[model samples]
Target: MAEEHEDPGVSLVTVDGIEGKLARVELPDGTLEDWRLASLPQGVKEGDVIRIDVRGGDVDVDHQETDRRHALGQRTLDGLNAQTPEGDLDL
Candidate 1:
């Protein structure tokens, strides 16, 4: 019989990109891996940093980082929108 063990350490990661239903994340150690977005918490988006509890495989958002990234993204979108004409904006 094989013995099962749980990991005791948590991993900090950031959302790098999304391909279809998979979310590519960058680990604290700088390794990249893909996980199912459906398996992660709600409202996760690119550039959002999160903490993963290894034992339970639970993910929690780093609110501060998430907010910062959200603001940055909004600013970027605003800039793009400004460059775009009123009727030419795509959604």
Candidate 2:
């Protein structure tokens, strides 16, 4: 399980996906949680990393974290792609 944020009431959650009015999120402990799509920040979509200030009752997108994670994922994908041979494969 992942440890909670240093601050008692602050933590991070990832928006795994959205369906209609609800969104499925992954908690810090890797458990699934459902939240209202309207309750989240405007323009939020799948794969967005959000910062929740539970004590302050504030929920907002953590843009830096999201971008960082995206970049890391892209690098991983690029590395994997580089490992493949550069020729067409026989059926």
Q: Which one is best on TM-score? A: 2
Q: Residues 21-61, candidate 2, lDDT per residue (tens digit)? A: 99998888899889999989999998898899987999999
- Cα lDDT tens digits, model 1, 1-91, are 0112244476667888888899998866677889999977788888877877777877888788667767887887788888987733565
Clashing pairs in 1: none
- TM-score for candidate 2, residues paired by index: 0.83
Q: What root-mean-square deviation over C-alphas does model 1 reach?
A: 9.6
Residue pairs in candidate 2 whose N, alpha carbon or C atoms collide under 3 angstroms: none
For every candidate, C-alpha RMSD to the true structure in Å: 9.6, 4.0
- Residue 9's lDDT within candidate 1 is 70
State model 2's lDDT: 0.83
